[model samples]
Target: MKQTIPGLIAAIMALSSCSQRTTTTNHVKVKENPVNTKVTEQALDKGLFATLKIKNEFKTGEPVKLKFTVYNSTDSVKEFCKWHTPFEPLMSKYLEIKEANGEEAAYQGPMAKRMMPPPASSYQKINPGDSLSVDVDLLKGYAVQKPGRYTLSYTGQGMSGLVVKDSVVFHILP
Candidate 1:
């Protein structure tokens, strides 16, 4: 009976320790701070403008939504291949994300090192005074996992020169 009691006590201690570790590892403590929405815009060399918008606060483990828009003010049409945008190939050539510590987010997927002949239909043509917008979940699209402040920048270009470039900031909560 004495041996049984000691064994039971040891089992309880082990279980308690395991539970504590699990809770400690799973619970993410976030620092509370007042944040404001960050929005920025920049005009490219051409008559194009780029805008970036992001929320000030975010919940930990939740996807961060990023909104990017490109506006063309020129009288002619602006054309870009699918590889240059985040449409099908999901390329990030123009988009850049950096953590608060200035560490840039690494590109998560395979990047095209060389230009390939894309299908004719893969080209997106924007008419004059038109705009193109993209909504992306930063977590799934960019592998943003930690809860902290992040900066996002976008540099869009056409076959010519620079089209648009802008940057914004956002925060992730616990």
Candidate 2:
């Protein structure tokens, strides 16, 4: 019988490819947690010298640390400049991140006019009580997945207009 109609059409194409591979593996293990549960905590001390600390609480896939401090406390040398070159330096450009129904965590790579380079300059000198520290890992430049509350602001501009702002309030648990 024609090999029983090609073995019943190969058993209905192997049961429709095993039910579409178990519905695409159950839709990729169903993951949904775009942060939302009504929570608020605001803290800001708008730059005057420099200080931005982050890490209130985190444990949902970890990795979000930012600690920047730049204070010369005046009385002599205090020169810091960098025309362009930021994918780090605490990710400046007046960094600001907000999430908790306010969105804005989409700075996810390849756009900074395409990794800037052409017009450049650089300098750094903080003396007389000195202070210049930087540590950043905010998921390698934002796009902070799921979890919860987050607000981080930074204003670090040096040279002639010397300014350094700070703000932090973070929490991400699951």
The C-alpha lDDT values of all candidates are 0.57, 0.51
Q: After superposing candidate 2, which stretches have Cα over 4 Å from the reference? A: 1-52, 58-67, 73-75, 82-110, 113-141, 148-171
Residue 55 alpha-carbon offset, candidate 1, angstroms: 1.6
- Per-model TM-score, in order, reads 0.62, 0.26
Look at candidate 2 and tell me the lDDT of residue 8. 90
User: What does candidate 1's lDDT look like per residue over 26-80, in tens digits?
Assistant: 2233322112332223333344444567788888887788765655555556655
| Best of the candidates, TM-score | 1
Model 1's number of clashes is 0
Candidate with top lDDT is 1
RMSD of 2: 23.1
Q: What is the lDDT of residue 79 in candidate 2?
A: 47
Clash-forming residue pairs, model 2: 47-165
Error of 1 at 114 (Å): 5.1
